[model samples]
Target: MTDTPSDPLKTTPLHARHLAHGARMVPFGGWDMPVEYSGITDEHMAVRTRVGLFDVSHMGQLELAGPDALAAVQHVSSNDASRLKVGQIHYSALMSPEGTFVDDLLVYRMADEHFLLVVNAGNIPADFDYIRSQVAGFADVDLVDSSARYALVALQGPAAARVLQPLTGADLSGLKYYWFTHGEVAGIRGMISRTGYTGEDGFEIFVPPADADRLWLALLEAGAGEGIVPAGLGARDTLRLEAGMRLHGNDIDRGTTPVEADLSWIVGWHKDAFLGREVVLRQREEGTARRLVGFEMVDRGIARHGYPVLVDAAPVGIVTSGTQTPYLKKAIGMAYVPTGAAEPGQTISIDVRGRPLRATVVPLPFYKRSRS
Candidate 1:
């Protein structure tokens, strides 16, 4: 198997547009991509208040189709696949045999016998290999890695619907959350999913790589009067953090189980056996050793990833993801602490740059916007 570092870096079809918009490019998950445009705070607020566009072509998009497609996905994921209908989508976690996370992904049931799995960019090759290996015995199933041929653009915020409705013939109003429909944008056939990572009403459009630049430029031109800004990964991070969303590598890893990461809700225990059923069931019955929780810094310091969490002056846990929230104007973070110390309002100390910063456990979703 090839290591992540040894693999050549990938570039999206919209790479030139990002550079034109003055995006600060950085290497992420073996991809040369933009980290920020304008500024993280400004771009983050634009999405919350108006609308913002994101080029997320770095994410992996794979198609699973065949007679045994449903069964294959059901066996690989913790979510119940039997409930999904055509044009519906569900958020689920892919578990290792030991019940730890392989990655968290969105599964879109495009048809009765076809599905699309949107996975994190860094985990694409590993995820593809793992899924392929598991489905070797399922002769009727076929898995195709389509990440290279498509580009995904996300139009997000309160005004997102208005900007996208005029571009497509599809009746987007009837396309409820977690649902999708096939549509045409600028004469290019595409799939539109009413899903987003940031907490907002939005649509994720999957179009051919050849039409990527055209659609991106058209969206900008259409939404130019509506305060739409081109956002980058830096702003995306702050937005998801404030919305209490999880980042794969930071908030979850191979060493952490879903139950311990406060993601047990994604596990469908009532369904038939999956890859990690025994371990998850055991964790559920006996309870997890640690739990993920949200906290807000009371002292003046930014709590960052890998910072030590202290209770009673003793190290107990470590912060996984954190940032100075652009929306809240405060330092907030998520960490894995002992269940006993995960209560909301509990006092904890985070060791920040050699100084202990006081913080209080807070309920998730530090920022909430009115649904459009």
Candidate 2:
């Protein structure tokens, strides 16, 4: 029996509309959210072939303002803030003093003295508090939580550009990757970022909470003929998994360092000092004990989280995330294994429900869409 609660789940600004459109609601990260509208496979395919909309209001938004805001951010974040130009965005990780990951977030430079940080839902409070405490002596820097006051919607797929072109006045084509533009959509102003988690061409729109419903309706209506469907968390997971994207708690935790997770690209090794600089530097010099890698099941059985990995029939690591790919029609997953077993084409076995399933380590980002 599933452990669903009797009480209705917390809804987003677009909750009523999601219900009206036949979304299957499920509890996720303390919020009641849609797992899918039509079907996970169908919705997943739609985003790959055409377009799909996702209500990601559960994400947290934070604002930093003041003369010392940039310096404060530089001290706390792992990314090199000096490279960020106005209207530019960067994917970075926040590390604890011990060098463990706090959360992976997107940092947007709105202006010289103002910036925005988009963080994961589960880590909002902890991230906010850690950042607040680190800003000591950095006077004039004010932190504000704007998560509840705003709505975030992601439109992703091959046809995303065409569908969104009619509704916004900004030149969608001009926005480069990791760049954003401020514009009005159906008379409502917001910022549109050309970034997504689905490994496809897409945009994430930040709008006022009160205008969320209208914007949702307009996009659906406009994309009706283009086969844009509303996707949910279920499809989002599979899509991101196939794309080799990492989830905060699943693929990485407080005990995992960015270097071990293969996310060292997000860390600024050249920077003078940051929260986890010493630990990261040590890891760089000494190498990591374990590393995250992709694996495909060569035998039957689905490998779910917490499953054991075996080397010579002896347990060596644990699975973090897994899914049956609708596109590839195969079992795939990610896990943290000893560095010696982390190479591509390495033969390994995962214990799935008491059975050993044959699998091979492979390169990340199992799927790549045509960017052009």
Candidate 3:
């Protein structure tokens, strides 16, 4: 998930804490971050069975306010923001007029005239600038990059709420998925959202930078009895991959449209005017030439990003994300392929270092938590 270190990297509020704990630091999206602590497999299992904590302070947050916020948001995002009630959040994308993702983001409706957009770490500047330029047409909308106000962390896994319930006065049990509440976490006032990249049930807490260390420590201590472990970017990637979550630069990019990415559900087809609506409409009706789908190796090989995909001995598409999942214990991946070859039970070939390996197209979310 990290690019080779070249430019000086930015540090999060909890960078020192990570170093103190012997986390393997790497440069990811211009930020110095922990790739792993104890180990990726151990951390991944901790989240699958018990609980895991993650320092996600590098994520960017944008706050939109003013009377025309809903209208402005609708114009820039793919989702129908007007449907989001107060305290609710929805997954959407900031897109160009051509339907390619500028960034996939979560839109939070905090109030009638205020909202929040949580974007990926790497695309902050571009995402913010694009949103600003698109929404500038609205008569009354104010956009502010508010990433400086919060140091974010996620308490994810089966024991997430159990671990976090004691720290906050807010009723964790009452907060449904994709909803958030304002409360004090370990005595530090912040916003807590019941959303996460990991497929497991979790909570992402946003607190001011100054109080991050204390909050982090308090959580670790509180969840110690529940076998909570500190996870890093490595585990995060594998977990999200298993959960069928997209990593920006990998799974989807400027060349891929939401329709081709199989995220057309986020498009508000009923909306009068929104960025990229026409292109999305045309794709949905006319059908995209290619679509993103999940697959698993039928042979002894692991798929990685940018690996070539072959359909009937001909190169079709390429792998977007893949890994030998810690929990599932199998090599699984996602890729864009011809629509005819994207369905489950379809067999395909992966060019694993020039050796063609057989693979089977499978339904997405290679892993899902048992609800019972």
- Candidate of highest lDDT: 3
Model 2 residue 133 lDDT score: 89
Task: Candidate 3: count the clashes.
Answer: 0
User: Is candidate 1 or 3 superior in lDDT?
Assistant: 3
Give one digit per residue, the lDDT tens place, for model 1 in 293-333: 99999999999999999988888999999999887899999
Q: Residue 281's C-alpha lDDT in candidate 2?
A: 90
The C-alpha TM-scores of every prediction are 0.97, 0.96, 0.98
For model 1, the superposed segments whose C-alpha errors exceed 4 Å read 1-8
TM-score of 1: 0.97
- Itemize residue pairs with steric clashes in candidate 1: none
lDDT of each: 0.90, 0.90, 0.92
Best candidate (score: TM-score):
3
Which candidate would rank higher by TM-score, 1 or 3?
3
After superposing candidate 3 on the true structure, give the runs of residues whose Cα lies further than 4 Å from its correct spot: 1-6
Model 2 over residues 1-372: C-alpha lDDT tens digits? 112467445579999998899899988866789999999999999998999999999899988889988888888888987789999999888888888888889999999888899998767778888889887768889998888988999999999999999999999999998999999987789989999989889999999999999999888988999999999999999999999999988998788988899988888889898898899899989999899999999888889989999999999999999989887688999999999999999999999899988999999988999667
Model 3 scores what on Cα lDDT? Answer: 0.92
